[model samples]
Target: MPDESATLALGAALWPQLPVTGCVYLSGDLGAGKTTLVRGLLRAAGHDGAVRSPTYTLIEPYELVGRQVFHLDLYRLGDPEELEFIGLRELLGQGLLLVEWPAQGRGVLPAPDWTIDLAADGQGRQATLAIQ
Candidate 1:
C-alpha cells in the first residue's frame, strides 16, 4: 500500500472479514493513515456521515450500521480510567471497537481480537495485521 487509496481499499476489504462484535486495535505513528482506514471501513459499511478522529473527544460512537461501533483515539487520554467514566465497559461485546493508540488504554481495555499496525515506509505505509 503506497497511498491513502490503498489503505482505504484494504479497509473496505476488511468489511466482511471484521467481526460484527469484537475488539480491533489499530496502531501506528502520526500520518500513518490509521483514521483514513477507519473512514474507509465506515464508508464501506454504509456510513453516510463523516468519520472524524476522536482525538479530543476520546471516543466516537457509530450506530445503525447493523451494530454499534466505537472509534477511540487515546492519544490525549489523561488516564485510562476515563474509559470507565465514559461507559466503555457497557459497550464491550455489544459491537465493534476500533481503537487507536491502544497502548494508552492498557489495563482498562479488553483484549483485542484483531490488531492492525500501520507504519510509514518513506514512500508509503506498511500495514501489519495480528489476529488473536
Candidate 2:
C-alpha cells in the first residue's frame, strides 16, 4: 500500500507479534518512507525520541517500552566483512533490529524475520511486507 495510513496500519498490526530475537529488513529507494514506517513502529512501541536514518553512524539504538531496539543503515558499509567489527552477534542479542540497506551485508547478516519493501509513488509510498 502506498498510503501512509495503510503502511502505518500494517506495522501496527505486526507490532505485537515482533519477536525479541529477530530482525526486520527494510528495502526501499531513497525517500520511500522506510524511516517513516520505523518511526511509526517506534511510536507504537511507546517511544518519544527523535528517529533518523543511521546513514552516517551506521546504527542507532533506542529503548522503547523496555525493549532494546536497534536501527541499522548499511549504506556506508565499505565491506560486508566490516560488520564483524560492529559486533553483529552482540547487537542481535538485543530485543529487535530494524535494518535499512541490508544488501550491503548480504551474506553476513542473519535471516530476517520479516522484510519490507517500499517504493516512492507521487507524494506517498508503496510498502510490501514478506515473512521469511
Candidate 3:
C-alpha cells in the first residue's frame, strides 16, 4: 500500500475473506495505519459510526448488521491477564476481533486466524497478511 487510501482499500478487500467470528492480529508501529485499515474494514462491514483506536479504553465494540466487531488496542496494557477482566474469552466467542499490539496479550488472547503487519515505507505504508 502506498497511502492511507490504499490501506483502506486493502482492508475492505479483506472483509469478504474473513470468517464471521475470528481474531485478526494487526502488527504495526504507531502511526502505521493499523487503525485506518480497521476503519475501512468496519465501513465495508456496514458500520457508519466513528471508528477510532481504543488506545485508552483498550477495546471498542461495534455492531454491524448481524455481526459484532471488537477493536482492541493493547498498547497500554501492563499485563496480559488484564484481558480476562475485560471478557476476552467472551468476546472471542461472540464476535470478530481486531487486535493492535497483539504481543501485549500473548498468552491471554486466542491465536489469530489472520495476522496483518504494517510498516512505514518511504512516504507511505506497506502491509503483509499472513493466514494462520
Which candidate has the highest lDDT of all? 3
lDDT of 1: 0.92
TM-score of 1: 0.96
Off by over 4 Å in 3: none
Candidate 3 lDDT tens digits, 1-132: 778899889989999899899999999999999999999999899888899999999999998899999999999999999999988888867989999999999999899999999999887898889999
Point to the candidate with the largest TM-score: 3
Model 3 TM-score is 0.97
What's the lDDT for all of these models?
A: 0.92, 0.84, 0.93
**What's each prediction's clash count?**
0, 1, 0
- Backbone steric clashes in candidate 3, count: 0
What TM-score do all the candidates reach, one by one? 0.96, 0.89, 0.97
Writing each residue's lDDT as its tens digit, candidate 2 over 24-107 gives 999998777788788878877888879899999888999876688898999889999888898887897777989998999999
lDDT of 2: 0.84
| lDDT pick, better of 1 and 3 | 3
Which 10-residue span in candidate 1 carries the lowest summed lDDT? 61-70
Name every residue pair that clashes in candidate 2.
2-125
